[model samples]
Target chain A: MGIIAAIDLGGTAIKGALFDGTGPLTKKNHPTEAKKGYGHVLQNIDQLIQRMADNKGIKVDEIRSVGVGVPAFMAEQGRRVVLAPNLGWSDVDFASDLAEQMQKPVFCNNDANLAALGEHWQGNGKDIENLLMVTIGTGIGSGLILNGELYQGKSGMAVEVGHMVIMAEGSHRCSCGRQGCVEALTAAPAIVREAKKLMDVPTDCLPDVNITEAKQVYQAAASGDKRALQVVEKAAYFLGVALANILNFYELDVIIIGGGVAQAGDILLNPLRRTVARETVFFQRRPTEILPGMLGNDAGVFGAARWAALGEAKKRG
Target chain B: MGIIAAIDLGGTAIKGALFDGTGPLTKKNHPTEAKKGYGHVLQNIDQLIQRMADNKGIKVDEIRSVGVGVPAFMAEQGRRVVLAPNLGWSDVDFASDLAEQMQKPVFCNNDANLAALGEHWQGNGKDIENLLMVTIGTGIGSGLILNGELYQGKSGMAVEVGHMVIMAEGSHRCSCGRQGCVEALTAAPAIVREAKKLMDVPTDCLPDVNITEAKQVYQAAASGDKRALQVVEKAAYFLGVALANILNFYELDVIIIGGGVAQAGDILLNPLRRTVARETVFFQRRPTEILPGMLGNDAGVFGAARWAALGEAKKRG
Candidate 1:
């Protein structure tokens, strides 16, 4: 039972952490420099893990294994990153490459899935046996923990709730070429797109600040800007419908909302909760508790470390 | 283990079967007489089970236990029929009541759930570890078998794919008081409703015979009736969308279509399959096999028998 190292590779940065079962010992971050290509990103991850190990005063040999969570689909039993639109990566043997360079066994999974495991292991969903975590950021992503285990479906593609169509004939188009998907309606980019539409319209209800991001829209809504309030309400309504659908399908113990858009807190959650209550088919019989995720951006790293530790234990068994 | 008895209580009749692990030894059917009240249905079920055992040349004492599948929600760990709109039953302790009268333990669960288990154990889903069975009848109902077990959500309410809203803000109203639910659009009653709407219009394409039943609509469609084809196509489209949503959420290995409407066979399945292929998120990567349920009406009885046998084995353990 040695220390575990974890890396969460995001579009902008690679976050690294060292853990020894109790909790994270040290954390560090390095620029992903994704645009510079996969080689540079791999090197950065290598350095990031080394720095995290050094910061924790641990030897490389003392670290049992490393787990990486990437914003991409993992293939070949998590030895490869098959696709990552954000990082422009495809079919990269990330786990094997990292293992070769770092001299430790490596495992990898979709970042969202790890976030769910992290939440179930030690965060908001610690006591939950089954849970769904939906992250509403640049694009919506979800992870499912079912029957006390992370359910990856038949091909590690389960819980793609974000692409579920809320509006069958919706006007908005998703990046996946689908129309009316939940991501198309309520992701951070969707909210920003809606707010930009409002900005172009002639209205005295416009916010004073330049509304460019989803956060600005939330801030304006909090300050009672009419246009911003309308935009947020629309996104919240769609998000609620999607959540209600998930609740109906999974009947999970709890649902954790995380990522950028969820930071609006009560302003977003209140309306979403109301919609879920109204939209859920048997709400009285199957009430689901919806809450905010506790670990925030660090959930992926914690989950990766936990996954690595679990994998190591399984190997021992 | 002794012989096992299973009863599938439908609105019209109670189907009973006796099994000795290998297969059913005898089968019998009795009028449910549901309109006479829950008491009459229970009495009829008892008589049916007695008849099944007697026909098999076995004494009631030889039967280890009875399992009942009802068109209702099983509550209190498969001991009570929480709700059955067709049977006009609510909160009936079906298991305990039957156990007391029959002098043997009795277990109960939703008929659809049993059908799924039956399919998994002996039918099309025998080889499947994760599967979804959607029964399209007067109303649509669904069952889920996940990780090789029946997945009843927190309170036996998971896989209510019937009430999943396929068309948000849709004009069709479901029996559950929801609009645009898959059941609202694709159930037998819904198809009949749509056909009637077309019949009300003055069109040369109208069927010569009155389309009062879903069967009539299918017959007309098979005979190249234009209006009926439109209605069936519309229902198939929505049903496809709902199935696609289920596939995306669960990433199940296979989907089995059962019940009355599925009797339309390829006329309904061909269009539905095409729509599902088009609507699913990653159909290319995760190809889900869609097929018809093999055991047909016998699935419920087989499922109930299997469930009882499993319960008896667990008790022995």
Candidate 2:
């Protein structure tokens, strides 16, 4: 009956958006200021949603629901955040806290899952029956939209595609304490690490831009550095293997690659697509296409708003 | 509203069962005689159903629906077999042919999915919201029962878990043209291959068995052959990795390990469980349990019968 408020609860920033039943009305980004403590983060989200609703000329209670996409492992249909290392949260009742803050029914889900939902609602994944949304940021994350719905497993932790190991011998170690995981090899940090490692070579191969972040690697590749391109290609190969493994099993309708590293465009995507095709079997039976996510930063908030609407309806029913 | 006939169309044998809505009435196994050609295989299925019906004092037309579980890649929601190398089937309209012969509605799915369905109907998977059943024999196969229903992806081919590579650097090659796949590293053939290589050692550590088959390896392990036990443990480790990967992502209620190799019981399961636990993360969040399949060979037929019951209803609607 009213507008829905959504928040993509990132570690450093919260991407907030307002949505009607149709599409996004407005979006705003605000600092999380997480060091101010848990209550402060909730107040930050509450303030963000309040500001979005204010911009839409709607009261907090007039908003249908407040939905949040947290960077955490959630359970209890996303009412709880089991662990969020960045936020230093463990087994917190996020939904209740947000609900109490806003005095509106709250809904929450994994940030990647919400991103997939966002794309399903307004981006490249619209009307796709089975879709996969892969987010390659500081850490690689993925979400499964199966049979036209988000497929959270029994514990609401399905589609851990980033952690799926593609190489057994590779030395890259993931934050999950595993080696050769997709996250270990393809995450933005991994790219930066690889660039850092390659820059130490006897021969000067890279275009120096003080390679502190993944963005510098893209910049180096933009300058047509062969070694930089090769680093990306190598990461793409491992990512391709992981994607193939996912596609071979999940057999989705399409996959949308999103997040910071994926923004490198054709350099990452062209090779990633080729690798997926090379590793996948029975392509003629069902061809699952790979594409870039269209929504950019707004995807998570859009997904969150949509989840609020759907979850609110489910609750009412 | 009549009795259902189910068939597990195996390469060498067809396991048939009669179900009266509630439980299995009787079961019969017959030679598939696949060498007799495709038509012969269909006829064998027809004759087996006819005999089973005659034994129950009913006409063929009395059956409500016939559901067959085939060991092949399926399309069109299991209406067609894309390929079955052992059965020499390729792009055949299996559902239509079976329906025409039996004079009843027909439903079909991958044999592995049917096994999972059977388990869901009457075994360890009963009432489970999400389940994964893995069959590891000639080649490893798997099925996902998600949200209390069989998850057949977009092309009716999901849960290709066996093809998920565990040891990327491993030398074993799978029939699907992939190296270090779960099938390559942990299938019965892989077990036998490992056993054979180790049997050639100077110490002669094997239990004096010919070791031409996976069963011999199990027998050797049973007779206190340390080499055979080690081979199984190694395979289990890879299987555990694959299982851990599946579990980490899918987060199912339970996992059922079935098929010829899985029958080795504690020797294989104990180590496999240990490995899964070791590789999996956030186990403290949701501890998924893995168990052995309870239905044995009857799982496929039971699953087929259940599919017939559900699919027949869906068709009517």
Candidate 3:
């Protein structure tokens, strides 16, 4: 085994890590400046990889491969990024470009999927055969590990749990132009949106803190603010319902929740667990454990590195 | 290849068939008399298998194995029926009992799962690698075939799509004590229930036909009854949402809808297709085909036989 460079491309920053089979040797980050366009982002990634290799005193040839996790819909063969709304990309062959530039093999996949894979490789889902990792942040993102392998559907678009409809005639609108989706109900933006509605209502139980962001709402709820608690409860309810739906549909061993909103801790987890237990089709018959993802933001980089290693191993075989 | 007996157990009837690799050699049915309890149902199944073997002039020794499909939560190895509400069964070792009685190796699984396997093996899903088969009958039942095999989760209870909650605060109550599950909104019983509600609303748009069954509602809707159309539209919307959710989560090649309500043909399929197309997260990027199941009720028996054959082959290997 040799060093592998892993990069996780995001809207704000690009996270990079150097790994050698066992674990990460070093990790670093650089501003994405996505506003500067895809070419700039690619150049930035190339520079970051070079910097990591130099810092580790490892020649470029010593690195077995490079892995990339991007916030995009990857093609089935992982040859290209089919779509990335935030990156403003479509059908970009990032893998080929990076591989050509670095003069090494490179593998790429959906960022969320990489995170789930990371969790499975070295985080919370290790030793678990089947699991679903859902990251609840600006939007809900999920990665499914079924039968100990990544389960990307026919078009490499499986595990879009956020856009799953939780309400048939729901009022909340998702950015995907759909209503009552899990994302529309439980995403950070949705929580903040609900808090904004509650702030206008005259209530003695309102938190003294000004509600501007989802974190503030969580803070207020943690402090026993009734209005904030209601908002959290509502979001937790929908999240729980969505989770129960997943449990019923997949029957996995564990469900790992990650991202910013999941940081609400017990405020979200307790209620979510309760709702999931209450709403699950047959709780007595089929029980699924729900837990928080252990790898935090580094999950993507770790997963990307592992993906590259696996791809290289497969190629060698 | 030796003859294999496949049995699909329903509340009122037990459908049986004999298969020898190529296709089902013969098919027959017998009264389940489930009201007479588990013993009677078992006897019925035994008698049915004996009758089929006799009709084919095959001795019991010529039958390689037996397969039974039941509406229950099957154990991981398909040894027992853990819980089947309709059959009033819990932790029943139906496979062992039947195998002992018939002196043949027996395999068991959920009826819907078998139907999905059947569809994949010989029905509409033939040659397809990943698919979901949803039977929209009195109660909605679904089976998922992922990566060309049945996807039974941790405890052999995966792919219970019918119990997936589609509404967070929905008024419709499912028999499983959940609110607004796919079954509660789209099952045949639910359609009939919604039609009855519309009939009492005092509208000239209501069809003159008695709204006692789901079939009547579909017929009225087909005949241009406005009230009936509205009910069907609502059910179709919910069904479409549920299907979309499955698509987003599983990312399958196709979704095959079967059973009584699916018989509504274009009245239901047309709207469902449109809704799925419109409400899907990224329609242009990922398109999933939705079609009606071809094997119909016989899908279960066919699948059961195939499952037994596969199990025997695996054992021999």
Candidate 4:
């Protein structure tokens, strides 16, 4: 059984897992510190892989391939990042650069796309063929899987469901320079922004809620706070509308909601399902199933490993 | 060496054409008079095919297959019309009845979808692989071809681009009960409706102008009529916004404009292109090539023929 190394590359940290054809056997984590520059991050990936290989008492050749899940639009084969705003990079040739240092084949794609793939392959949507895995963290993102294959549109930027305009002249401003996008109103900061505007809540109200994270809005909503509930409901409506638009557009069988916001569960799911059901035009038939992510935080790593294994399979085929 | 029969089933008339397995050779036109009942219409089709086959000294089987394009949603191997508001049909087994009468395998699909496929197979989009054929007629209809294959979504209702809501609180009401659909604002009647709303258009000022056809407005605009041009520009802007939304969503390579309103040509195309370029997010890198449809009115007949030919190929395969 060949070994596949999966890496979830983020701005603050890099998590690596070693899988022997079946599942993870050992894992490692390291700080990314993206502001330090691309070279430093690349160096960190190289050192982490070396340490993992040494711990298993195996040579570099013993590993079959390595897969990476990044937060960016991959043009094709995940060789270069077209534009990753979080990483503060443009057109970085991470695939070739990493292969040169690690001396192994590397497969890469957008982290959200990979998470979707991970969920489709090994999580809730295992029995389903067509679905979308939406990741809602600080920003909103999605990976579309159609006809049992990843639907990367022309130029590889197909499923921008997050930026899909929900309101024509909506008040919220999305980071992508578009107004009325679902992400503009539903993302983490948007929730906090809405909370601050709803009440003259002190700075301590926010700090006490999360201290270090923005996901606490869900917690407040879960705690039965009226303002927080309204904020979450607003996000749910936009998400539901966006999902309804998606359901209207694609006729998808299921949509798996992931990311930090999904932790609120019923606080978000009930309204979302009702809104989507009400908003959808063709409600006579089966409605799109909304489910929680089964893979959780490990989804990106698992998806990356799946990407590597599939690449190896394709090469042999 | 073989001839194929193509039929366009309309509420008012039934249009038929004979092709020598390549292009149209002879045409036969007759009234559908569907209110005369289903059996009469079936008999009409039988007589039409018999007359054409006898005139050419050919057996019906030598024609390969018969294709019927209906203005409705067809499914379950074209054995039924899933829904068609215009024809007042619901789950009617039109295809099977037609195939049984003709004693040959028959294929059926929505007329607009077939038109796009026809354009892709032999008309304007012949050279382009990823194309979106948008027809601006009685209603806005679209047929999408992606990666060289016709993309029908999970429930076979994909590519209903006309119903895509462009305006949230839009002033116009669509035929589908949706508010602010592109079809409600830019279709032929919509263009005419806007022309009627223009203030102080003395009845004699633009003699060619009327509130029935888009061509009247085009003629008026050509004669340097300000009111006519304004209406045309408004319709064109809405169309451009809709196209921009589609491009932002799908990243299609080519968009073929067809149907009655498309006759305005450059008057509509020029403003549409400018608006789309301005509204689209990735306008610089991913430019969608907008072009005029080549098949004109014959697109429906040819598309019907192609739809029929697919069944013929499958039987022989």
Candidate 5:
């Protein structure tokens, strides 16, 4: 039994968890000033992993491997971030560098993909073989598990479901600079943007409340606010449209919705179910189940641990 | 070496070919008269197979398997045609019925899918894995071969690339009753319709010309007719759009273009390449090689033979 360090690299904070052969032993979080240069963040991760390992009474040599989750497309063979729009980094050899510093086998993958794997290993998708984990945060992201394996396709960019065009000629600019991306319209920020357009919202109720906050939009919708409800429904429509298209393409059994905006619960799910049912071509054949994510915020950390476990298994084999 | 009986079931005729392990020993064609009854067609296939095998000096017992192809979605288990809009057949269990009479293992699949598989086995895709074979004929149809295996999704409706929406709001009625289907605008008939509306060609100039016949459009386009060229280019645009989308989803190495319309060669391919270059989201990342199919009219027959071979292998394993 060896310890493995799992790192969830977010924009604001770098979350790390140390796991002994079985489960997590300790967790740590530190602010990531990405603008300070990439080198600084790299050093920060190395130090954090070491500190976590030390706290757990494990030596650096005792740790079998390290799993790092980043926000981007990871190449299948190289395990490098091919394109990460969020980090403003390109062609970064993350795995090799992380391995060099940590002095162990390092495995890197898309954060959402690792999250899906995490959920598959210990969360709601534990019993399911074919599952789609749709994360609804500031941006909509998805990770697909097809036929009991992570289908990364030829280039490991196969499951870029968020970039898929849900609505043709949709009037929204996605973070990826593409139009009609499911992420552009269905994400938390997009929901808030839609809710802010209501002329009567400010005067009627919550006069000084900011519309940019996704939770405010959810609260207003929960209070029977017409504009807020429409905004949430529209977001759900796009999400459902994308989910339906994916269902038709891959034909998965269930879609687990996670992330911050998924907190809206029934308000988001009801409209999404309606839109998915109406838009899907094979609605009559079999209906896809939409369930809330069970792993919550620790999904990425759990997934990172799962990734390390799998890597250890592969190495042992 | 065992002889294999292959059947290519078309709307007008049933083409039968007998293969002695590698190449065709003898070929025979007969009127299908599908509108009459399913039993009549089945009997015709039986007689046709017998005649071909006899001509090749092969005993009925020496024949390994009978492979049949249809213009519809084959069920996951390859037992029946789940849906064939053109043939107006649903859940037709041709396998059990044909197997009972032949007293041998029988295999059947979608003609387009078989064509793709046939190409993969002996034609253009022989050396390549992870290919998308698109047949541009009466309607656009595709078959995906991923990781050296035919990807038949959950409901055996995997590579339905033609039905994918190209123009979210293109004013066209797809044969599937869906609007904005790539097939609706890019199919051979659609090209001819656009050509006829744009050009005034004399009957003598293009003999035996019809909007439904892809050859007519190719003829006009080849003769330097401006309108015909425009129509072909338009179709190529939509076709390229769908292909690019597929490329984004699956980073395939090659896309083998087949079917009757693909006979036009560069008249369709040149524009498709250019359009795919401009439209594909991942155009800057993974580069895909597109080429015309080599199997031509014999693709289905060869595919049937290959399918039979696969079935035998599976049974042995």
Candidate 6:
């Protein structure tokens, strides 16, 4: 069986991996360094794949296909990325361009969808037919797996959960030029912003709480910091509201909360679960299991590999 | 070919039809008269079906199968309805019970889902693979058609769009014991409540708005009633927000707004279209057509007949 080359292109890091049918053979990560320009990123990705192949005693050209996952709107059947602020791209054919650079057929999709796919293939949701995987990092991103397939709506813009407004008024503004989006209230920066709002009124917390990061807020909350706990509670509540909406809308089986913010563990999860239960329409039906992503960062790469394999099989057929 | 009996059981009326393969041969309606209890309701339904068959010069026993649609949470593969306050039933196996009364195999599902399926078959959707049919009547009910199949989630409780929270704070109370739900803010009664609240103020239109019913609100709005326009605007905005959330989540091709409330026409639809465009995540993608249903009340019966046909085929397979 031929090898599959997979890459998960992110704002800060580019995760690359090789799959040999059964499982991954080698995996590594490199700084995205997107500021260096598109050509630089492309050459770096090509080099990364070459090195991965060399390490596995195989030539880069021997790979069956290259699958790439990007954190952006993938449209026109993955021919181009509509917009990717991190990569400074808009209406550019990243997929086809990369295919040209590597001289091979390329398979591409949204990173969040790939993460859901990877999770479905071997992570927390292993082989489940219906799932919604949400990644909560600098911004919130999600992907849906429906009827055993990745559900990218008509324009390849399905599962955009972050933009769903929970609080219609008196809510934080989002990057999408909207207010009260789920992402604006719960992403890492929002978590830290909310914590800082209550930093003036100290209650069982550090006297000079220099909590500039979401991780620090989580740390403080874990240690019973009252203000930090409130911040986490608010974020978790909004996330749960959105989840409840999703659950009732599609009735998903599993909802995997991944990315940087989810590492808060039980503190973040407990409040989230409580809110979902309170907000859910199907209290009597089988409740969807809300879990943290098991594959972590490797989720996108695994999904990319699977996507490539499927694409290659389809081409052959 | 044997006849297929189809029924759309509503709160006040039972719509019964007999279909012979291609189209309905005879159709009729009878008052539900649910105040007489479950046994009376069941027997009445039997008579209604028998009359439909008799009008087509066929015996009741000659029917191949019966397909029924109810406005409630259908569960356990449509074996029983968990709750249908309209019919005053709880945990009742409507499918098997109807099967016994009709002396034939029966297929049962949510009325909204069947509406969607019917729309997909011959109504506004018309063979469209991906659609969301929302019926705004006494309560908001919705059913999804994805990839040309009716998408009923696990335990058959999917597309409960009305219960999703749109206004988190200081919103009206919903029947589900929640506040600010899409149903609470935009359903027929909600529209009337909102109009009544505005009636106290003087508008350029009605002297005594006395908008006792949702139909009157539409009529008022149609005549350019400023207060009524405000109510319609508010309802349209919330509905747009919910539809935007749905459009982003599933990426369906068309959205059919049926039931009695959608009769407001362009007054409701124009504002709804404008709001959807404003709130959509995929501004550049092919926009989902938000249109009124074409089949009117017949959408459910057509869907029920289609459901029976498919079910009967599956049984043989």
Per candidate, chain B TM-score?
0.94, 0.95, 0.95, 0.92, 0.93, 0.96
What digit string (tens of lDDT, one per residue) describes model 4 on residues B176-269? Answer: 7766677888898887787887834455557543456778888788777888888888888877766766675576788999988898888888
Task: Give lDDT per model, in order.
Answer: 0.82, 0.84, 0.85, 0.77, 0.78, 0.85
lDDT of 6 by residue, A196-224 (tens): 88876555556667777899889888998
Query: How many clashes in each candidate?
Result: 0, 0, 0, 0, 0, 0
Give native contacts recovered, as a fraction, per prediction.
Answer: 0.56, 0.52, 0.81, 0.24, 0.23, 0.65
TM-score on alpha carbons, each prediction: 0.92, 0.89, 0.93, 0.89, 0.90, 0.93
List the candidate 5 regions with Cα displacement exceeding 4 Å.
Answer: A50-62, A166-179, A189-210, A213-215, A278-285, B54-62, B154-158, B168-173, B192-230, B279-285
Candidate 3 clashing pairs, residues 3+ apart or interchain: none
| Candidates in descending DockQ order | 3, 6, 1, 2, 4, 5
Candidate 1 chain B least-lDDT 10 residues: B200-209
In model 3, the Cα lDDT at residue B264 comes to 89
By TM-score, who's the top model here?
6
Q: What's the lDDT for candidate 1?
A: 0.82
Error of 6 at B163 (Å): 1.8
Q: Is candidate 1 or candidate 4 better by DockQ?
A: 1
Q: Relative to the true interface, what fraction of contacts does candidate 3 keep? A: 0.81
Shift in Å, residue A313, candidate 5: 1.5
How does model 4 fare in lDDT?
0.77
Candidate 6 residue B199 Cα shift, in angstroms, is 1.9
Which one wins on DockQ?
3
DockQ scores of all models, one per candidate: 0.52, 0.46, 0.65, 0.33, 0.32, 0.55
Tally clashes: model 1.
0
Q: Clashing residue pairs in candidate 2, if any?
A: none
In candidate 2 chain B, where is summed lDDT lowest over 10 consecutive residues? B200-209
